[model samples]
Target: MGIFGFFILAAAGYFLYRNYFTTNTYETKDERYNAARAQRQKELDGLLDKINRRGMSSLSERERQRLDELSGK
Candidate 1:
């Protein structure tokens, strides 16, 4: 092969090696976060159910605190 062809092949090989070895670790973390979010949403849904049945005023102080803690606000 000519010098140019040899360099082209070398670059291609290097790119292939990099592409093969790169880690995609974010997907696993994103899945965990999605699961936690879904669980939190379910908990909030339950709380809303309580509110619907018992009225918002019926929420105890502890329940309000718990809601605030979960909401981080």
Candidate 2:
């Protein structure tokens, strides 16, 4: 019974620590949005470069779908 109580207390403490003490990678909504936009643009550029070098046929089905998504098709 004592060991079980200790385990419950430790679990609750861990939950509180994780929920209240963890720091987010981005500090604000605008910063997070900009970072995501930059990453998407970088990926789009790489995909376009691949197509330019190897032709659109070289893109796998997944890559083609990703291109459509990034280009807002």
Candidate 3:
């Protein structure tokens, strides 16, 4: 095989390996925002559930602080 052919194949293999092995690469800002939003939504759901079942007034001081933080107060 010609040197040029070997070089082309090696370049393709390197690219394939890099693509397969690289950690997550965010493609757009929206992707990053969505991930953070999902996490926050999950946290809010759990917090709301606790408040509902236990009563907001019954929550401990720490739980109240968490709720306030989630509400951005």
Best by lDDT: 2
Error of 2 at 43 (Å): 0.5
List the pairs of residues colliding in candidate 3. none
lDDT of each: 0.85, 0.94, 0.85
Candidate 1 ranges beyond 4 A from true positions: 1-27
Task: Name the candidate that leads on TM-score.
Answer: 2
Residue 50 in candidate 3, Cα distance off native in Å: 0.8
Q: How displaced is residue 28 in candidate 1, in Å?
A: 0.6
Which is the better candidate, 2 or 3, if ranked by TM-score?
Answer: 2
Cα lDDT of model 1 by residue, 1-73, tens digit: 9999999999998997777767554568889999999999888888878989999898999988877877778
Error of model 1, residue 47, in angstroms: 0.5
For candidate 2, list the clashing residue pairs, or say none.
none
Please give the lDDT score at residue 14 for candidate 1.
92
Quote each prediction's TM-score. 0.53, 0.65, 0.58
**What's the lDDT of the predicted structure labeled candidate 1?**
0.85
Model 2 ranges with Cα > 4 A deviation: 1-26
Per-residue lDDT for 4-65 in model 2, tens only? 99999999999988877785544698888899999999999999999999999999999999
